[model samples]
Target: MSTKYQLFIEECQELLAELESALLELEIEPGNIDGVHRVFRSLHTIKGSAAMLGLEDVRELTNDLESLFDRVRSREIACNPKLVTLSFRYKDMLTEYLQDPEKGLPQDKTTQILMDLEQVLDAPVHAASRPVESACEDCGSCRPENDKDADILLRLYHLRYHPANKSFDSLDPMDFLSQMQQLGPCEIHASPELVPPLDSLEPSRCVTSWDVILQTGADEETIRDVFLFLDDPGDVSQFREINVDEAAKLRQAQAAQLSGLLAATNRPVAPLPADEDDDLELPEPTESSSAPSSSQPGSPAAVSSIRAPSSPAPPQAASQEASEAEPRKAPPAGGVKAEEIASIRVSATKLDDMVDLVGQLVIVQARLKQIESELHNPLLTSVSEEIERLSGDLRERTLSLRMLPIGSTFNRFRRLVRDLSSELNKEIELKTNGAETELDKTVIEKLSDPLVHILRNSIDHGVESAEIRRAQGKPAKGTITLSAMQSAGQVRIVIKDDGGGIDPDKIFAKAVERGLARADSRPPDRDVLQLIFAPGFSTAEKVTAVSGRGVGMDVVKRSLESLKGTVEIDSRPGQGTTINIGLPLTLAIIEGLLVTLGEEYYVIPLSDVLECVEIQRGDDEPERIAKAYDVRGELLPCLVLRNWYHMGSTGPEIEQVVVVQAGNRRVGLVVDSIVGQLQTVIKGLGRVFNGMRGLSGATIMGNGALALILDVASLVTELEQREVAGTGRNKRSDRSH
Candidate 1:
């Protein structure tokens, strides 16, 4: 696809998201005129853009929806649930068309929706029933039917637009003119005199200025809104209603008089290229214009009215006239200047590439430090320290560029909740908070499916039926809250539901039935609940279309692990369930505690490290050291790396215990010696090492050796499971006695 078309698709996706969200909100609060306007504006923009891209079918479908909402905005029709549903269907169909225009619109469905929209529009308005406070305060036309209404008189408007140079990237200026033409009888004049010669002309730029005289019943704001997307529309465009007396003289004015008047108010333009003749012939202006006509000069709708020829006035004289006429054109009353574009769309691939480059720089900086330490040269040490400081700053800023507010991702679940709740014959509302919490772009992209699956599971499994909830003294409408906040260097996202929580006894029974646990096992409720994430594990008796195949939670587990994140669950049988997921801020580089184990080095993520302390280990029976260790008072589980990995070498007399928190548990990781802390650039293992247990990924050491990054959470879990199994066997032996 062309770049422009790709951008158009991206823009449509964003607008569609906004449209769906607004429609959902409107369904909840029908009296919200702000929501009505949001829906209308999104549709209007999509329709205009579709028209610019020559997608007539898309334009037609979107225009119908836009008009429907416009009526809602004007208080001519009430906003209802049925209208929101219809708008959602339109939004979906528009998305499909934009993705593959060749397939065209589904005729039967499109016709049905249009017919429904017509029925809604034709319905009688109940002005007395509407909430008067909900009426749009600033909208002049947004009045109830019983209000004292004045007849809208046709007024002539003179508009001269010199579109901002940057506007052509997204909006076509000609489309604005066509929209005005749709308003009423309009005469369009194009000034080609400003166009530079062939060598200097930009094919994509809108250089030619336009002067239009339109007669319509539309208000001044309506006319001015055509150029609303332009930053500082008043700076480049002029729109004023002509006086009744001047309207008569304007029609009778000669070409010379009209040309002089335009020259006095128009901004100066780039002169023609040097090689071009000064007497180039100019195209004649059209006397009448209409929408959907040929864009070229002399087309059927391009009739002449007022023409500005190639021969121009002296710059000095034109400047004086422009200055004198500028004061007469006052800013519109109560007009707020449009803010400039604040952000631009960037390609994900480019951002990923930039991150990779930054990661490589971090590795090289580490190598420099290694050299400086060995040589101990004053000059080299100074240079290395400076490079280290600069690289650290650069790494932080570069990584932050990929951080995006998770709110957009959170908003997506609203539609899912609405649809699924209806499908399940329940009333469930999805609430979100701390959506402004940010995460790396890559993390967010991969995080989407896991979150969706969790939400679906929450709706299908966690939430009880509305009848059941009411019987239990809970509200009939269940609520699922998705909230996120940054903690330490990790973002903690909690998805909580106010529905029937999981029963640990049921989960334990299912685990035993599936041979995932011993029948004699009696673990803690938290441990049993964690079994729900095991592959092919399910507590459901029968499979349903939504879930019960026991696939989603496992996938959520695997995906989170791939991002070096952890997940935990908490629940009360009679209360509700809350799933907490913790993910690092960035996956590229992290601060790690480097240590050695029998000649091998490993990096443990510092975010999880609570503290490091010395522990005594014996040369013989080193494996016995993999037991509980006392930290101040509480005993924490400890895992000796040399024994866990089954290395040939034995442990030293003294060992370092790195206490790290994984999920809700803190464990001690024993190593031969501590290498201090350093920034470790994470590198993924190849497919050969994929799914390897205990190690999440590999990183490069300052001395150019590869150190496996320990998956502390997984390691801690494995140790706990081993200890539990050993206890189970001992209990069975006691029963035999």
Candidate 2:
């Protein structure tokens, strides 16, 4: 695709995100004018840009939707539930078409949807006979003499015109005046009061000027167009529109008989006219009244006097009164005040390029740090320290630029719940919290599908039917809560539902029936729950369109592990189910405990390591050949890395065990020796090692050494599987494998 088209797609995606947020807000408040206006503005902007790019289909569809929202804003029609639902449908269809324009649309379906929209527009409005007026009475004046001969009055002050030297060659003042005359007759007068002498005046400069009287039937817009071409050359210093109605009312109020008659009827009279030469005088009315009567012109009344007395007041008046009553207070000290947000259009490719550059910078910084550590001069050491501090700050700021709130990712589920609930004929309420928690942009993008699958599973199978819930003494509507929080150095996201929880017995039976486990196998509750993460294991009685496809949770687990994260489940048979996901704050850099097994080096994430213990030959042994350690009365299994990876040779008699904890499980990884701590830059294990079961990823150390980062959770599971198979005790099997 062309760069312009790519940029258009990115801009459209941002608009869709904004539209989704506004729609969700509308769903909650329904009468939020700001939210409605926001959605309307986004749609209008997208439609205009799409048209400019020759995306006719997108432009047309969005234009139609924008018009619908415009009517809602004008209060010509109320927003009903049905209209809101249709708006969501329209948003979805537009999003899909924009993402894949080549997917041909069905003409019949498109026609039906448009026809349905027209029916909404045809619905009766409350005040269909009245036409809305756009002119502001406060800024302009109007005169209505018997309502048939109406004239507008205007004022002008210091109106100067400048003509470009080139423009004067092709155009004359007479031609411009002729255009103005078409609107109204112009009576010109010249003032040579400030004119310089002929010799001082350059022929290139405009010396001629005019004062004119204009009388026309055209509106203000047409009158302004006459001077449009003159804007660049010079300025029209001042212009004003006058109201003839107010002038006539002032004349009538000055007549003594009118004032006396109005006073007797308890009606306020209009203001008397001031002398034309008295520019500083204010209009003085006969009485103080808030509004002017239609019979009187030139009344000193509110600017809104032109509005019908029965009509609703302008919404701005209420806002103005509110502001007057309680001025906006200042924010508290040390707080980040809210500022107006501006939306900018950017191409996705640009963002991708930026991320790639940042990644390369991280690698370069790592290399620099290695070089700095080896420098010996004191002056050089100080300079290196300063550089390191600055580089660290830069890296942090750049990474933060790519972090976005999870709220945007969470909002999509609102529509998902709405649609799925209607289809299943069930009542479900989705509650969310900690939506403001931010994560890596890439992680957030990849989280959407997995979250959708998890939510769908909760709604379709985790929650019981409304009738069943009520019978069980629970609320008729099922509730699902999605929440997130940052603890330690990781983000924890929990998806919990107040419905039927997972049954261990059923999972166990399924595992045995599918030959995933032996019938005689007996495991703890936690172990059985972990089975859900195994490939092809599911407890659904039958497959459905929504879920039960048996390809969801396992994939979710794998994806999380690939990011150096872990997923766990906790459930009580009659209570509820909660899925807990713990993810690292960043994937680029990490503090690790570096160690060596024979000749190879590896890193264990500092966050996971509890401590390191030295294991003697016969000090503590729990089983034959397999190493185990007792730390604070807890027995932890230790994996011998030299045997696991088949290292060539061993040198040290003493072995080191790195104790690591993930969730509630603790395991010790035995290595040849501990090599202290180092800051490492994470690198991916390429396709060649993509299927490696126990390694999460690889990284580069300071001394130009390649270190493998172990997947702790996966290694622990592998150990358990081997132990269950009764082959874990065989030393020969471990060495060959």
Candidate 3:
């Protein structure tokens, strides 16, 4: 794909994520104005960008969604469950159209959504049952007249024109008037009643009005069309049709007076002056001007007598003469204002690539620091320290570029909960908090599916049925809450439900039935509940395919683990369940505790490492150091690296025990020597090692060496399993005794 197209895709994905999160929030607090505004803004932005790229279908669909939001924001419609559900469908449709504009708009689903939206919007307004009428009192016409077979005619009328100061530019009044002339003959009479003196004219301010006489055989529709494009609908006033006989009489009198005046002038005949009065006044044609011979020389006396003694030249005529003698003013300094021009669209992919390159540079800088430490040269160390500081700053800024508020992803779930709850015949309220917590763009993208699955599970299984909830003295509606916060070095996202909690016994029985555990297995309540995340583990008596197949939670767990994250489950038999997922702030660079086993080096994530201690190894050493201490009384089981990985050398005389914690368990990993702390650049293991155990992945070290990054959680789990199996065998032996 072209860079721009790629960027569009990335931006669209981000917007979609944001839209989902906002929707979820709206599900809980349907009247949340901020949530509604956020979703509206995303849709508006997407629509604008798509229109810029000529993606008409995407633009049109988003425009409709935006209009729906406008109604909600205006309080014209209450946010009902139906509206929220429709919004989710709208989001999905917009996403589909963004992906493939040629697919030609959303299918019938979009129409249905829009119909539902209209119904919601029209509900209150329709209940009032009031007839809609034109705001103008004199104009009885409800709609504009057609232009076909229209004749341009001119009749005198008192008119008032007020250009909306906020809408139309001062220099552009003539353009609008010119458009008006297209509909009919427009005779403009300048009314100087409101005109201030030239010194205080305020050229930018409108200082005059036009008493216009427009004659058109076209109906009122054509006349209104002339002003339809104007920003202020109420400005064009005193509009009505006049009789043709009256118009003809006025024209005849004007012609006769002009002829008499021309006869009186010794010089060439000047143009007839326009009236300055706000009201229309047409002089009566009398017996004195019955003949057309007033143009002759002998009629000078008659012409002079007909002219009013004290009347001065009309303002229009003087203004025209003055305009010929003066030049127009220049525009203000600084080229055209920025707001007058349109905005440009850029792809977000280019920005992402820039961030990635910056991350790599940070790693390289870390390596240089290592080299500087070994060199011990004063000058080199000084330069390295400066570079290190710069790199650190750059890394922070680069990572920030990829950080987006969790709110973006939270908006989308509103629609999901709205729709899913209705489909399942349940009432679910979704609440969200800490949506402003920022996380990596990639993390946000991967989080959507898992969040959706969790939410679906909560609605379908965790939340009690509406009937059951009501019978149990609970509110008819159930609530699902999604919250996020930054803790330690990771972003913690929790999805909690106030519904019927998971049954530990059911989970334990299901695990044994699936052969995932022994029939007689007795584990802690938490451990038994965690079994719901195991593959194909389900307690639902029947599956309807929405969420009950029991394959979703496990997938959610695995997907989170792939992002170097962990999921924790908390539940009570009669209360509710909360699933907390902890994800690293950024996946690019991480602090690691470097250690060695034989000739190979491995980096353990520092976040998980509790502490490190030196263990003296000798023939007299205990067979197991389950009681190893690290300044605390806590006993941590130690795993010898050389023995675990089968390194080809004798054990170290003094092995270092790296105490690492994953979830609630802490274990000590024994290594030959400590390699000191190093900045590790994570690299994915190839497809061959995709399913590898114990190792999370690989990272490049400062010395250009490949170091395995230990998956602390996996390793700790494996060790615990081995220990448990050994204890079980020992118990069997005791039974024999």
Candidate 4:
């Protein structure tokens, strides 16, 4: 595909996302004029862009939707649930078609949406459903003098259109003019002044300008919508509403000009008075015009725009009238200027390549530093240090390019929650917080599935139904808040729901029945809760479409572990449940604590390390490899790396215990020595070693030696399990005695 076509697809997909969001907002707040206008503008731009790209299917479909919202804008057709649902279906279908335009549109879905739209447009909107326009009339200062005046009033508009870029690649100005004609009786006049002589004229280039006089009841903003797809309409088009006196003057002036031109050309044709056409009054549009434009104007010779008055036109007022009308528009801080924001769309593959290149540079820099130290050459050391600084900066910058706000991922769950809530016959509101928290783009992409599973579980099991909630003295509507934040170089995401929390007894009983827990032993609540993450473990008595096959939570656990992240849950029986997840800011490079165990070296993520302390080794064999050590005053769980890896020799007289935080507990890793902290570029072990326990991945050291990166969370979990099994054995032995 051509770059232009790809870009068009990307742009339309983004617009469709915004369209869905607007439609959702409209569903909630039917009177939200801002949302209605937003829906209209998104559709308008998509349709115009599609037409320019020769995507008639998209253009036609979007145009129909745009007309529906246009009426919603005019308050002719009230924004209703039926309209919102139909718009969503259309948005979804358009999204699919854009992704694979060669397949053409799905006729069954398209026809259904169009048929539903027709039904909605033809349905009568009761007075109660329409927004109350006279609410302000009771206020003394707001009442209009003419209380019985017609709601829709005809206005005369003058418009000038000149193509900013004469190239045919951009949108055709004639297409916009045709749209203007549909509003009412419009006279179009084409000026051929810029048209060159036939001998010199380029057939592919357009130089003609158009003048249009449109008499329509549509507001100035509505007219501006015709040219909405232009990158910058103000540069090529001008709109000025003419008052009654100005219209009369313009008509007389235009008639004289036409007469003079006709006589000078020696055409011998009588010039009709402009007012003569006024006899053909343009009838007002019906309550709504939901049909797409049937055809494009073949010629621009008939176009005419109202002439400007002697005074300068108020272009700012005319362009900003729509915004001004929305009294409760979102504040500047809350609104994003998507079009104005300077940004470029880049592919994930390119970013991945850049990250890979940066990672190589870091490895090369490390090797250089190792040589510098070994040779102890002053010049070599200086050069190595400089290269190190530059490489470090480059690495940081490249990794940041992969960082994206998690909000987009968060917004996606809104649709999921909405559909599920309706399916389950519940009323649930999904709220988001700290969406601006940024993480590696790779992390965010992988993060979506886990988040979806968690959210589904929350809606299915965490949040209670409306009847259950009300009986429990809670509001009928349940709320689930998904939030994220950054702290100490780690992104923390929390999925919290205000619903009935998990029951420890039920979880433990299910675990025993599933053979995942001991039937004779009662574990702590925390351990019982951990059973939820076990493979094929579920507490649901019966399977349902949403969940209950015991698949989602385990996937969530494995996915997080693969990302070197952790998840923990906290619950209050009747209050709610909150699941907390911790993830690294970037996965490309991380600060790691390098430690040597016997002949091998390993790197521990610095983010998890709390402190390092020196401990003397004991000569007693059992004491030397004790599972617990006293750090300061507290007895922390300890793992002896040398013994765990089954190294042949243990020669160290003094060992360093690196205390690292794993989930909720702290564990000390005993190693031969501390090799200091360094930026570790993580390298994945190939498929041969995929899912290797006790190791997340590996990194390269300064000496070009491989250092396996410790999966502290996994190791800690293993240690805890061992302790639990040992305790169980001791208890059983005591009962036998």
Candidate 5:
């Protein structure tokens, strides 16, 4: 596809999103001028871009819709609930159209929407376009009636039209003429004489200009408004008011001179008008015509417009593009504000490439620093340190580029909730907070499916019927709140619903029946709630279209785990359930606590660590699998790493314990020593290591060795699944493998 077409597709999608958002807002505040403007702008942009790309079907559809918005914006037609509903349908249709780039919009749907919009607008839909009309009334008056007492002066403004660098293959000549009429009725003449032959012509270049005569009573300022958007950097100076007689004389002299040259060269001159063919009614030729006897006496051989063989005549397609303005460049504010506001759209592929390059640079910088430190030379040390600082800054900025607000992901669920509510016959409202919280784009994409399943579960199973809610002394409407917040080095997302909550007794019974729990087992609330995450586990009474066809919560858990994230569930039987998901701010890089275990390096995510403490010799190493550590008078179970992974190294006389939190549980990790904190880019281990119990990912270190990134949650869960001898009768947790 052409680059312009690709841009159109991307831009169309963005416009569709904006259109949906605006329509939804209109549903809330029908008279919001800003929302109406937003909808209008989005529709207008889609129409112009579709036209430019020759997507006629889409152009026609948007043109009809744009016509309707114009009426709504002018308050001629009210924007009501029916319109909002139809607008959503329109969004859905455009989405389908853009999905397949080869095909335009569906023929049937496009026709139907056009017919419907045209009927509502009380107007006819044209496949091509209409002429622009003067904004002022068509009384043929030169000035406003309110200025009757003032001296009425007719100012002739000479305006010229030129095309941009983009192709103007479909531009109409008379279209811009109508737009110019808004100032007042004006006579337009086209000059295409400068156009080259078809074989030599550059398609993007314009070889045409229009000679316009304005008969407006309005001042130069009002006349200038008609051409404001059409003016480019240098074009503005070409537009100014000329006296009517001088303009007419200028035209006559030029025409006479041209006709004489054409007659002398034995070339046929284009016919001038005996009468104006247009509605503008051009005036009869002045006395100068009688003096020009260059040709036969009765010949009407005065040139109106010279056109190339390949170009369409000016009248057939008026300059349709003058009304289509290029995007505006906002004026710079204070230097700081300008810097803060400037931004450009970059493709995901480009950003990913930058990230990869930056990662390589970081590794190379670390290697250089290592070599410099070994050399122990003052000059080399200074240079290495400076390069290291620059690389660190570049890495931080690169990673920050991957961080995007969660709001865009959150916006998608609005449509899902609306449709689900309708299908389930429930009065449910989705409330969101902290949507501006940022997370990695990769994480957001991975979260989409899981989020969808979670929301489906909430609507289909979490919320109760309206009658049940009222009976329970709650409001008739159920609310599901989706929120996000940034804490530490993690983004926390909470999906909570105010509905019938899970019952621990029922969950325990179900788990036992499914062979997931022992028949004699009596688990606590948290353990019972976790049974929902077991594969193929669901509490829905019977299968329905919405959910409970047997695939859900477990998938959510797996998806989060793949991102090295964790999910936890909290519920109160009569209240509601809230599922909390914790994810790293960015998967590209992280702040880690690097430690050495048996001469091997390991990195633990810094977000999980609460504090570090030293342990003495003798009884420091746990005699059994689970050991209890007293930290500030609170006893926490400590998981010994060297023995579990079989590192095959003797325990040091003194060891360090890093207290970390995984979900709601706090535990300690035993390592030989803590080597402080450093930021590292995580690289995934291949499939061979995927099945291993407690490691998440791996990263390269300054010493040209690989360090394993710890999966704190998985480690905690593994410890929970094992029954131990030492840590106060450690009971194996009921967590799934």
Candidate 6:
């Protein structure tokens, strides 16, 4: 119902995930004190939060778990496999409790686990068997057994209500007072002697502190039940029983103190304005120091009040005020709350909007600089240069705001690895490195699905069985290592596994069966390995829910391509497999090289461009060209950009070529000119241009011109496809068949 409650629910779910992970780890290492403490803290926090929300069953369930961990902490009991299993069951119970708080706690499974827990808890304790009379004598406070209920006390209760958040938007203090009135005779008072002038008052703020004396037959517990949702136990609020006579005297003292406090601070005013109502009253100083003249001083007509439940004794804070009116005591140890962490929760949409706005500013800055250089005025140029520097700095800082460590994404896989390995009957270990490396939040969110596919493939297909690994002179447990590092302006993630690797023959056969590979073709080993990424192709003997779907590896390739990234895999028949993926740091903006092909502009990401060099080609016709170029002494494969785009034009005698590397291959891109580098804001080419390849996105330049951004990774893949198409199965048919 309240935003704070909603926030609590969201956070609770996240904490539960971490809690489950910790318990599973603890199950493996029973002596881990840190793990036990982590579980205890999570459960304790959940219990207190549930108590404040008045979710009784959820609170009780968490309390039980916290108590179990407390025993583990005290060395009274060790963490066992059975207890960890029960803890997981309890975790699920908490989830169902959140969904259906009204339904009674499900008793069937909980009862058995609880009973087993009791037996386990009692196993180590050897209490002496003693007679009933002796047991009674050991505890004098314990009364003799009686069926009749103990007499209810008429003692007074002192209650102080403090809300978790003091803002009026979160809670109402008067509504709490009304609930107290429903219990018994209650009189509440507030201290408002220094009320700011009416015009200066903030209507949304809460300034009044409550002091109340509730005269009721209800014991302290019943009285406390009224403020259950208002405060956590022993905090922000205090409820304790006091002597009835003392409560009466205290209320009288509070009234006297309030009157005295008001008379001391009140000052008489002259008159009211014409628009002011004549009946509106203001406090006037009274002659007597102990009592007020007619009306209570701070009791304004607009304040929320309850009718006196009985002989009106001023509320608890009044009594406290009376005591304070005498002397102040030293503060208690926990009188102040710990300072809140310095962070803000912002939605992803907000960050995207900020980047978009910053991108616009950058484009305008470039436009201004272009105009200034054309005019060649000293003063105008100076201003433009300053604007350019500031905009660049602002762009960097804005993009950094979207950068988050990749560790959170990596940590989520730990649980997946633990669960899936158990289900598949495999002994596997996952190790991660460079988790602290940072990337754009949007890019990281898109990475989860692809990483899952890659990791699952490594587990289900690449990893060999324990028996097979041991027989092959490998360790019984297979290891999957996921490491990431920053390279140039990209983040490179490599997932390597120590398991049985891909077999080229099987991959080629599977591709041929799926009509992807020619029946008689005999490609190189490396080329055959690439067939795993082809759509509708798998080497599985049978289909299952997880792997034989045949669509996973293709999905990984497509998702990575959408982010302007590249994925390459290497495998040996028995040495295991490794997959390397490279992605741009951020998709919001990139430093790009602007080039022209047939008067149409294009942007190639500057990160991928190694250098620009002039190329010498003898022929002008596209059909007469060779696919390789000699740069200095090294020969590199070339992609003729002008011919590829069907511009129907020839390049000059000496053309500029941008040498870019994709994976292990280098390709020369021929363009008319290299137009330096600047930051480009990437905009998507919508569904109408979806079929286009090698072009990832579009951007606007300073001269009101549009440039299509080139995707080097996909371009190289396209080149590979063309090469394969040209050398058809017919060329190699004799070698295989």
Q: Tens-digit lDDT track for model 2 on 146-231?
A: 43212233321112233333345544666455555434433333433344576796666566554443434444434444454342
Alpha-carbon RMSD, each predicted model: 9.9, 13.6, 15.4, 9.3, 10.6, 13.1
lDDT values for all models = 0.75, 0.64, 0.66, 0.74, 0.71, 0.71
* Deviating ranges (above 4 Å) for candidate 5: 74-77, 111-341, 617-623, 723-737
Per-residue lDDT for 1-737 in model 6, tens only? 56546655666776787788788679778777778867876776576556556667667767777877777765667787878878877877766755655575687866766786676676462222112245434221243445122222233455554443256875567656765664556657574644566798777766565666665554443454444345333433444444333344545555555655555669432222334321212122223212321133321112112222233234465566456432233222212223532465777789899999999998898788778878999999999989989989999999999999898888778767777787888898889999999999999999999999988988999998898899999999999999999997999999999899998888887787778889776678878887788887787788976798788999998899888898888899899999999999999999999998767899999989888999776563444222677889998777777666655567777788999988777888888888778779999989978878778899988877888999898778766765766621112111110
Model 1: per-residue Cα lDDT at residue 266: 95
lDDT of 2 at 170: 47
Question: What would the per-residue lDDT of candidate 5 be over residues 1-737, giving only the tens digit for each residue?
Answer: 75656677787788898898888778778878679878987886676556545567777777778778877765667777767777787889988877776876777876777666666776433323222345543222433546432233344455555443334564444444655664555666555556667798887666666666555555544444333223232332244444433344435534544555466669966755544443232223334333332222322212222222222223212222222111123223210124554686799999999998988877787788779878899998998889888998998898889888899888889888888987888988889899899888899989898899999999988898888898999999899999999887788999999988889889888888888888665766887788898998877788888877557888998999998888899999879989999988888878899998887889999999999998764454444446676878998787777766765556787878999998889998888888878677789889877677688888898778999898999988777765321142223333212
Question: Model 6, residue 25: displacement in angstroms?
Answer: 3.2
TM-scores of the models, in the given order?
A: 0.80, 0.69, 0.65, 0.78, 0.75, 0.72
As a TM-score, model 4 comes out at: 0.78
lDDT of 5 at 458: 93
Q: Once superposed on the true structure, which residue ranges of model 3 sit more than 4 Å away at CA?
A: 1-91, 106-348, 618-631, 727-737
Find the candidate with the highest TM-score and give its number: 1
Error of 4 at 261 (Å): 14
Candidate order by TM-score, decreasing, is 1, 4, 5, 6, 2, 3
Please state the error at residue 227 of candidate 3 in Å.
Answer: 23
Per-residue lDDT of 578 in model 5: 97
